[model samples]
Target: MLKKYILFFALIYILTGCGTDYMLSSFYLRKDFTWPTSPSEQKSLNYYKHVDGDLTKFNGYTSPSILATPANYLLVIYEIRDIPIYTKVYGVDGSSDMGVYVAISKNAETFSATPIRVGGIADDYGSPVSFVKGNRVVVLATGGIGFGNGKADEITKISVSISTNNGYNWTAWTNVIDTNIFKPLLAKANRFYTNPGNGTVLVNGTLVCMIDYKANGADTTPAGAAIIYSTDNGITWQLGSTLTYSGHRWARVIAERTDGKLLIAAVPNTTRNVDNIYNSNGALAWYMADSLNGNISSFQPSGLPNNSGGSIAGDRIQYSENGRSKSGILLLHSTPNRDYKNPGAGGATGKVKNAMSMSISSDEGQTWTLITNAIGQQEPYDKTSFRQSMKVLKDGSIVTCIEEGDKNVINDTSNQPFFIVYKRMGLSALSDGKYSYEGL
Candidate 1:
């Protein structure tokens, strides 16, 4: 009877709040958690694992994403040379491409960048996200979708490469989605949008991937975060139905919850672009899909930036905890500040660009309680940090990899960087201000 009562109370404590420290009323507010006191304390909250802290013009790391391997390894795929899309490359006026690099770490503490080139065309192929089934490791990347004229040839086909011997070597190019699949879809559409930052997940014995495109011939017709999935080890794929959402802006991240539901997050602001980093409307809108091929729920606001109402900071990360006793979903996202024009009213309002935070959901993703200050205060109002990836180790320790760049004060605005940084901490460490990093 005593044991039963104890378990009941513990359940209540967890449901009421992840202990009393994370007690939140709206899940969109970041008022309760303990924040870092000083710059030193904030530094303690986020330290580095791998990075030289150099800042060059187009040389620093930009979009960093991660995946877990079969043998408990963290496979990180990010763009080297760290150049942005649709820029000059190799002295060409309109040539821009980045080399895709993969790093494998067995313990998530130490990492080594492999020499193998994950899928990439000479034109543009970066941002490779991985998925594993048994011993097979499949890497899915882009062929560079062009904009600002008629330069959308790369978006015609979805390129893929597979490896059975871990992160050693990759196979040749395999077009998962041929030109017939996407070319016809985009032929009629006047304004089309597609970025290389795609996401994938194995759902109900089928591998599902998210690709956003709108071919309604007008911007008025809401663009959809469409789906393309493979069931046979990525050897063959099908162009599934379009999953609709709130405001289909930029690339999205898809994560499966512990309850077997999938949440796809996208940038909801269509009027804004990269030129103006942070404007008035800056937040991530999410939609829950029963299946990638099934009907998607209506669009709604997410609890990402907390009360700060910050912009969609970077690529949002989602992970349902490992093991049989799956608790809930852990969503790691970022934002610059609540109100960029006017400072500090609510929604994590401050001048902290690329500022990171987390939202925990127990009942799938129906509601989220924001845990503010996971890696907070990147800078005073500039871009402190952006584009991060996380790995939930077998031992329940979640470690995140971050980029410290020109905006983050890694180096001055002159030199770029090739290295990214990782910090060692769990969810509780975010509120406690435990900023210390060890292990390369």
Candidate 2:
């Protein structure tokens, strides 16, 4: 009888070792698991990080957008449920799968309960953004295919929802533009394959957005980026003049420059290695575009080596405080760099060299200067931070939103899992990478 029992145990071990990752993950799910009582239980730091959009034992979150309004700061996130794929195999949420969500914060530190969630809309895959148009705020979000976040049929569309009360509440997502409207213009890439979304904004008060559509399901065979712009408060959108650059990733709307110049920053897809890390030649391009007219100029490099080139661009969010006087663009961006082993202890995940670095551009998208290299970088494999949103306070402090993880890989015991992390960087001591709200 003891021999029989031993034989059964051995069989179980062999099956677990040889079985598919999904099967193994399913087995583990059958075990007892507990969701964290809360994830924002961090010690006080001047710089802000996660605002309740974090990972729990059961649910995970991703894609953070930070918008500063007169009353309070609004942090919007796309919630992923059913915790699929990488999160499933080990374990996470689909920012793209769930429609839309928002969490409000008065000072970018403490957050209210998940205040707003809009559903039934497709293409929740892209980053959702908020902006003050007139008295109300508008949220622009996208959903796409190939995210593996469980959108049944290659969902591709950009949607708009409005909040009259500064993110305390929100309206349902209304599909602004779908793949069918833009597919005709993107025949160049054959189709927008694996066209995962990036960002949206009110460029120079004109709405500009990006949408990717694929021929088949997550085929990503020839990924494409379809660009669009609107002048009439997103009532209508214009298609790109040419569909050649469908391969641009992290395509985003930079603010309307004081000089009346509209810009778009993006990186070409071919600049990276098979591992999805940028090779030596990868470049992040900023294009001078029109908010009303699309693709006013070709995308060009910012004359800077955006190290590893995962930098995403956003509008020149204004902040006026303190006695210091400077006349230039205050461009806030989210950046990422290569991961590395610890120089001393050399842990498996290694010290995140600079996964979630922050850069500021006083030169109107021409160049970027690193402000903090230590805030959001976490774990090893460090591919977690990308295409996030940022907002600056009146006192020169900043709040940025991003998803943290090790790599975009899947493993049960893997160190990385997708969760939204909001970091605060102080204006006074950027060198130390501390969050000091002294001036504000």
Q: Compose the digit string of candidate 2's lDDT tens values, residues 311-401.
A: 3545344322244433334344433344465434565443332255555555666666565555564333344454356655444555667
C-alpha RMSD in Å of predicted model 2 compared with the true structure: 15.7
Q: TM-score of each candidate? A: 0.66, 0.65
Candidate 2 has its poorest 10 consecutive residues by lDDT at 34-43
Please give the CA lDDT of all the candidate structures.
0.49, 0.48
The C-alpha RMSD of each candidate to the native structure, in angstroms, is 14.5, 15.7
